[model samples]
Target chain A: MEGETIVKERRILVAVDESEESMYALSWCLNDLLSLHTNTNTTVLLLYVKPPPPAYSSLDATEYIFAGDAIASMEKYSRDLAHSVMSRAEEVYRDFHPRVKVEKKVGSGDAKEVICVAVEKLGADILVMGSHDYGFFKRALLGSVSDYCTKHVKCPLVVVKRPKNV
Target chain B: MEGETIVKERRILVAVDESEESMYALSWCLNDLLSLHTNTNTTVLLLYVKPPPPAYSSLDATEYIFAGDAIASMEKYSRDLAHSVMSRAEEVYRDFHPRVKVEKKVGSGDAKEVICVAVEKLGADILVMGSHDYGFFKRALLGSVSDYCTKHVKCPLVVVKRPKNV
Candidate 1:
């Protein structure tokens, strides 16, 4: 006992979005990953990344193409969306394991970039995310945020797919 | 006790290849997923999918473009590769948990289709795979096998990314 070192608590980051795919991932993390003996002291980090606000050119700004109130409402909507996602994730976590410690984080930027940066900053042992199962054309057009994070994140990454019936 | 229902053994399918990424995934599965208390009755299916052999056109057949011996040797090489990958995975499994059950399976066809079909045929509850973390250009040029499987596999799919320094 004198020479033994204490094991550090594992940090697991789950990326939450508004889609059911993401909610299923949260459930999977709670049921499959966190409920394991190996994850006894794990801490879950619920993260939501919202796309950055649209940029307007100087000419458009001067012409008042978008009203100030409209821009304010759009910003508020994004914030509300992020908050709602985190709240739903919290409910799922509480339902699965109420005693587990969880932290909620929100960032506005490219989802891929925000996820990668948060994983590093949080020193996460593993990052969990849900895949939307986008087809070839859609994936090519929209670009896969999880795919990008898989390449950029330094920690082990788990991309969970939602079951069809779910 | 007389009325107790039997618990079904969980099947976990892991897609293995000749790359370090796949090997890392095998290691992670053994250490993290299989070592958990909830996985006591789990059986792991190690699958290796070899690309389909090149097709010979009628013109090529008439011209005798491919040497018979060369074609035979190439097929043998692919078989050998699949065998070696399974052997390596077995080593990893034994290193982590010697008592766990593991089965090796080999298929020839498009990697994506083979993996999806194997998961269904095996009735796997979960499919585990490794991501090579290919860049955007390479991924677009040569479609990712794991990406395709993630979208197509009916079971819960876990795509693991190896830690950068590891």
Candidate 2:
């Protein structure tokens, strides 16, 4: 390392979900991108965004118990899904680069906003995401997370699109 | 090298210009991003887009000679600029990573369209660009090459923004 340039540690944030696309992005970042930076210290941050809980309106006396149970169950499901996504992401890079540092964060809000804020908060050097490849009409109506982040994130962004036939 | 993944060659198209912002991006890609991919075969493609020659309409006899001279000078300038830009890019990466394979390409047209078409024609696995960081008003009016490429490029894209203070 005598002649090598050693800069401060760099953080790369990978936004993940249950979709295979996100997982593929994480794997690609590790196997294809992160492996080459032999001199720089890099930490991979994994972010899982849970959709905000639905609003529960005023419930009649008879409906109160059921509503409470439903809310609790939904919360539990969200927690479980977040855990599963993190676990899968961990399995990916850990297998590829055993020594790379990993961090986990779960945000509850609109993914586009959450991801943008997370990048700023974490001071990420780069943000990596997997494109959902939503068609023109669907993307227009629902909005794409990667597309939205591109306009808003302060740091560099890499949107990985899995090949259609792969 | 045993047990390492040796995938097909990867093509990374990096759009460059005379701007320091773009040069920073090329350095970042070589120093931080491409350095980590220890096993994969990667080629760095440097693309330079020259503004299309101005449309010269029919001119009166006296104007024709001067116009021809001006056109020749402008073409020479464009050619010289392209050469210098490519030479600078090669110097940066060669100093950083001597063995990294590099290819140069020059295209004439609107930057956005030429970049998008180049990615598709080259079958680039990834497209890397430097953001101009145009203010909201300017970006809306002039349009950004990186922004347009994000919408149109078929493969993954990375937009690197150089910090203002740096």
Candidate 3:
């Protein structure tokens, strides 16, 4: 960052839960980064966490809420979720920041862990993601992330809020 | 925390450094909260930690250095710094957030701690502040205060880039 334009060179990471809220956030992040006329490269990861396969039992209250050793079924679900999320993400990006370059990744893992791993692996300087749900927002805040990075990492982090539109 | 129409009810703790950059942050925070139209009562704490008076130095390079404290003079300088900071802070609030009920406290302590302590005692749900030097867009935030709040606190934080006007 020695005398270089800070906004011009940006590497952004957006975590996608395939929710309309997440897509909206990605849209804002992409457009805002490009608006700065910055060199922007975005890698969006559509992440899904698999709750441990529910104990298969007839007496289970929500017995059907189980994803058994159903590898084939899981793969199909993953592909479908990825397809929908990417389609929405791409559409939003095209509408807001068509010129910005983007790469996509889809995986199943803990949302926070997946994000932390991607940030490190990509050497991303900015992590642009959605405001978390009330439960998770407590720990996962745009504010908290920026604070954490500022204290520990020598990079910049931008946390974008979701627009009202779906 | 019950059913309510108040928007942006997140408690915002704004730290003022008495710098133009800080004032911009001050305005942005007020406007942002006001827009939410929440039961937003902003407590603006004007913090100014006076540098200890320079010891009568005969040595070279002493001009640029912070000479050790003149214990006797610390009280006078501290009092003066407090008055100057609070006056400026009031003017800033009157100009920007006239509707916001304001409060002032001067701590002759570290900037970050004073801010963190205020937030804890007041149950601030948000921290608003400004960053120091950056590039063309003075708001290209890469600062210690904003970063510190982001990492250590749980509330949502909004850091306004110092308005470029100044």
Candidate 4:
């Protein structure tokens, strides 16, 4: 082993959301991939992206006055959701890979852009995501995050699709 | 641990080709993913697809008579190419994952269909592929195999994009 360069650590970013599919992905990554991998230096990065604050175009004085309050409440709601999602992900990690280090990340912007940027900025070795399996029409309308990341993310990307029975 | 149910084995199907990208994928899967993973129960299935024999429709007696010989020679060339590709892949596996169990499979058809069918038939827990990174125009015209498999394959799909500096 002398003179041999050993990879001390690897960062794996897992994108989570409120959807059941995302949770399943986190569980699968932990139970099947992380737990099975012998690399003790692996760190799991759990990322949750909140949509950007809504823009209010209303010019009415009354509507403009309340816009700040409305935006504040929406931001608070987003923060709460992110926390809850991270907690759920942490629970799965604790159950499956209790010893592995886990980092929580919350980004606000388009999910696709935020995820791609995070992978690059965090220097993730691998990026794991859950596929929504939105059918043709819906996928076209909604734009799939995994699909975008597959094309844009610089690192290796894994898209886990939950089985129907599960 | 006596009564704990342990998964005896997992199948990881890796699609290979003559392209450097696919070879890079195989190496990455072995060195970065398989070598680090503690699971000794993993089995790698290497699948290679050769394009279907060319169709010859010649009404002339002389042309028809020569067509058989031409087709035979082409078939032989295809077989030889497949063998060469397999040998190259085996070499990589030997260097990186000598002890890991690897099964070689050669199928003749469209790569997309063959890969998807093989994944389902083999009950692969994960499918690893290399992205060609064909830009928009090229991808639109040639159709990316990884993109197709990502949408169709039942198991989790990992698309490894070789780092540009590498």
Best by DockQ: 4
The residue-level lDDT of candidate 4 at B73 comes to 91
TM-score of model 4 (CA atoms): 0.92
DockQ measured for candidate 4: 0.65
Candidate number that wins on TM-score, 1 or 4: 4
TM-score of chain A of each: 0.89, 0.91, 0.62, 0.90
Task: Give the higher-DockQ candidate: 3 or 4.
Answer: 4
Worst 10 residues of 4 chain B by lDDT: B32-41
lDDT of each: 0.80, 0.85, 0.54, 0.88
Predicted chain A of candidate 1: TM-score:
0.89
lDDT of model 2 at residue A9? 91
Select the stronger candidate by TM-score from 1 and 2.
1
If both were scored by DockQ, which would come out higher, candidate 2 or candidate 3? Answer: 2
**Over 4 Å off, model 2:** A1-8, A36-41, A55-67, B1-9, B38-42, B56-70, B87-91
The digit string of per-residue lDDT tens for model 3 on B22-66 reads 776666556543333334444554445454444464855564344
Please give the lDDT score at residue B24 for candidate 1.
Answer: 92
Considering the two chains of model 4, state its CAPRI-style docking category.
medium
Interface alpha-carbon RMSD, every candidate: 2.9, 2.7, 10.5, 1.5
TM-score of each: 0.85, 0.81, 0.45, 0.92
Error of 4 at B64 (Å): 2.1
Q: lDDT of model 2 at residue A38?
A: 63
- The lowest-lDDT stretch of 10 consecutive residues in candidate 2 chain B is B31-40
Residue B58 CA displacement from its true place in model 1, Å? 3.4
